[model samples]
Target: MFLRFGFVVGQAGIIGTMAIVLFSNAITLLTTLSLSAIATNTKVEGGGAYFLISRSLGAEFGGAIGLVFFAAQALSVAMYVIGFTEALVGYLPDGTSPTLVASLTNIAVFGCVAIGAAWTMKLQFLILAAVLFALFSFYAGAWTQFDAGIFLQNTGSGFSGGESFWTVFALFFPAVTGIMAGANMSGDLRNPARSIPLGTLAAVFVTGLIYISEAILIGGCRDRETLITNNLVLSDIAVMPALIAAGVFAATISSALGSMMGAPRILQSLARDRLFRWLQPLGIGSGANSEPRRAIFVTFLISQAGILLADLNTIAPLITMAFLVTYGLLNLATFYESITKNPSYRPRFKFCHWTTSLAGAIGCGIVMLLIDWQWAFVAISLFAALHWYLSKIDLSADFGNVTSGLLFERTRKNLLKLEGELYHPKNWRPFVLALSGTGFSRPHLVVFGHWLTSRTGILTLGQVIQGELDDRHRRRISQERMLHAMIGEHGLNAFPAVVVASDYVTGVEALVQCQGLGRLRPNAVLLGCPLSVDRMKIFGGLLRNLRGLSRSAVVLRRTDEPADDWKPPSGTVDVWWRGRANGELMVLLAHLLLQNEDWRGRELRLLRVVDNEAGIDEVRNHLNGLLKAARIPGVTKVVVSKDPELAIQTTSRNAAMVFLGMQPPNIGDEEAFFYRTEKLAGGLSRVVFVQSAGGMRLES
Candidate 1:
């Protein structure tokens, strides 16, 4: 009915302007199709656009876009109020002041919205009837004037002055954006699962058909000059101009009231999502009806700010950008849901396709850029900033975002592809089997194992509970609970399992034997230092068994008390290399530990002891070669002393942790190996004794 709005800005002929409308409707149709598909698939709730987006794309994206959608809805209230005021001025006597009429009209509209939603909705139905009558009158009056020759006036001249097709297209786009009217009211609908798809698609089809028919009637009934000259062509063509004016007034006021009501609802939803701490007060509903009084008041203030502006010419582009970006992201979200191939993504609506969603997304983006490149950039930047902030906050909405499913699908495919690929040295990772009973008594063992794995490999905490087969189930459950508590409390990303065995030795054997699966078996095992002679025998036996199973082992003992160091910890890793296979494994483990953020930038020192000062340089040179071959950065220090224990203690006093190679402790002896290592670490920091078997060799 108001197709002439395009002709005032651009000199485009009737058909040229209608082309813009058709394009906009095509996007709206696509969006409607996608929205229907999603609404049918899931249980759509109050958040409307935000609910759909957050549940599909994740909270970060949903929160970010939801903020923009709220602002757009609020600003749209001002836009419609201003339009209503303009229409009011058009009907008044020629002497009437336009500014005074607009100011009073704005106040009346705000008051109507503030009174209550039920009253406004009742008024909405009355206005809708007036709009329908006006639409019918215009079509009826213009039917007699519709001549075949009128269609021949196809010259693409826009306005009497001149304007680009893109400029004209921007103005027409908002007409099609009405498809979201039904979606914004999704919260209040009783049967959103059934109502949203049916209602939204119906609106799109009806509105789309009306706009297309109106475009044709304008082109077929009027000449180019008449279309350009008459800005109020709907009134000029209507049987009764007053009825058309009534339609214009009702349409504008109803639109303004609708946005005024819907904007606050979105704000309340956002506040409930904890999008910002300050928005908490807005989430509180005041009446038995759960009215968003606080949110409504805030929206009123924002609308007043817009109303106070002299013109909406500048704000117009921003509003369009907001809608375009929202539409684009909505399409993108649907596309991800379809492409993820998740079994849960079964949409009840059969017309949905990834191709349709993709096209809609790409179309929105292209149109947004074409309309205004700088504004498009600004819109995207705002979206990105909001997304980054929400991600950092780590807000928990638990909306079953599609990111995890997408990543899982990709990971599965990549792993399958990699199965046939050749192995390489640089790709090697340490799969560690860290044995710590409950992992609580010795927390550092698990922490160090996590560091050694560098988050790129698997680290499993294996606890062996000594119990009889009769009480095995209960004991295993208890041990598993304890293990889980330790893992959670420490914030360690490691899996845990418990085995019930008759004795400690049997438990350790079971743990070592069943550590991992086919290609993911644990290549390294970590253990705590033995405290007694009986434990020493168990440790030696376990070490022998691990060696037979082709695994590397590290026996650790902390000498000094632990410190609460900062992350990417500030300390040194001293590897006391003894020129053996175990020493090689120790150096490699130290290198891997450095890969973790907790150990990043910490010092890595490789120390060796020699009998004389003359051979110290030779030892340093040899260690340097090993460091180069290992492709790890380190400082090689050669100590010229007869006593290596004194050398280790004095040199590693300030180090965070020290690593040294050792032979398995003898059960029959004084357990001197453990005692000697304890004495060596007496005045130093934490220490770990490395013992490597065949499976621990460098990957290359």
Candidate 2:
């Protein structure tokens, strides 16, 4: 397909193809660096394209771009499938055309490939090998017909303009588009930090070498003018039309598969964020790679749709636009990180000066804007829409999976806060949120408490691995490997830096206390309840002592709904609200209403008060006054009463929930008292508690 569609770089000269390679290489490098910054700070998940960008940038922004990327790939894949199959059918009896057969065959191929990894892997390998071989052979053919003089003869490509040289760059730009095939696989690779950057760099260099050599070879053709003007496949000179067309067929197939593979990952990433519910079924929160079965299927269907919409002629422009959009963002991300002096960010790999990348991106964006204004407009419009959606969206509820790394665009500030290096007025480690043990709940608990304070914390997972090493180097490495694999596989790439400490370590007291750690402030430490009694006692004592050393905090308890979904009584989102230590919970009703999308951006009214007696009349009178304040003619009001029993009555009288605070027990038995609270509110209404314990300790 490369040869047929004029993707083969011999369509131009060495300089022309080299230009494309340079741009692709630079763009790929920028993207890799951005992704690396995100990966180092957060664990990567299945949404290969969406994962890194969202983490580095923010999920909302990431989700928006993810949707666009997914759409582009889906469309590109269909184009490839339809085009390739149609060509395959051309080999049938002279009297018959095989387009329909090709479509059916391609659909079967899609089903078989998407159904399982084994088949997909096998097909990918075969396609890759065939294309690699064809590319090699084609380059070899070009060398056999090398022409240095021809390069100089038509360097202008017959375009009579002072900017003719740049015209050549424009003509060969589409060739650079294929480099995304390698870049898009960042999340799938075993070692993305190392392999993603290396593979992309290698792909760029090799592609450049092949393209430049081919350009020189084909440029020197005996009838260079004919090849340039007629747009004929390079093989017209060699007379082996069969072999050349066959090679084209292979390359096109490879391109299509590559596009298909890439698109779904981006879609899957978006779905992971719950941005595109339609695609969520594909990567549906399961499988090793979070395969996103439903998302992949939707992508495949979308691709087929695109294929139907576009024929051989119109598809090229859209695909080019997609590539340009990605490249432009890549350069922009690199530039931002570079100027900001972001940690671990380096521009060393960029092929040219920073200005060059900016220039290239601008050029690409301009060309795209000029070619298909409507499509470009649609893509940009959707991206902006998505970013706005992300900007306001909060993912604290899914706190475990989100890395603090994405919290800010500028990096240096975050590095200090994340690494536990910052100092408050009463500084030490700001607050030690001990991730008590290894379990599904650990990351969320630790990150949450950490968020509450400086996030200078640790999460200890007492995992039952197949080993018996005690803080041994090998054990640590093994754990890291396991964690890396599990984290990536589980798509928890966006997580804080976790140090898997030994459970056998006799005392976590010193570590938890941040004892004698010089200026490294460790205030109060948080611990979970699942540990052995003896262990908790020891850790609890240490926590108390640490408080003496520094004003420490301890919110020790188990979740009432440990492994269950939590729905607080309406806008009562359990906010440790920034301004007010505990803000009005009545707005929770607004939040509940906002969940319906149709009324999200509306004004809200909430009922708030302070009570000491917890009396029924006091609550009802206060609630009634609050309800009066909420009278907005057409708007709705939901009140979650402060008293559980009264709240239940209110719910029956009018839709409402019972909101209550966790009352620390000193007068009565602790367990019995909390258990009574649970029993009391069990069925009255959506009884809720502010999660003061299991969350990232807020820095402020």
Each candidate's number of clashing pairs is 8, 40
Candidate 2 wrong stretches, greater than 4 Å = 4-17, 36-41, 93-102, 147-151, 160-171, 182-187, 229-232, 237-241, 277-279, 285-290, 330-374, 390-700
Q: CA lDDT of 322 in candidate 2? A: 66
lDDT of 1 by residue, 308-413 (tens): 8745676667778888888888888889888764334556677879999999999999988888899999989999999999878847564466665454324655
Model 2 lDDT on a 0 to 1 scale: 0.49
Per residue, candidate 2 scores C-alpha lDDT tens digits across 550-622 of 4333343333443422222223221111122222322332233333333334334333332344553555565
TM-score for each predicted model, relative to the true structure: 0.59, 0.54
Instruction: Name the candidate that leads on lDDT.
Output: 1
Give the best candidate by TM-score: 1
Q: What TM value does model 2 have? A: 0.54
Clashes of 2: 40
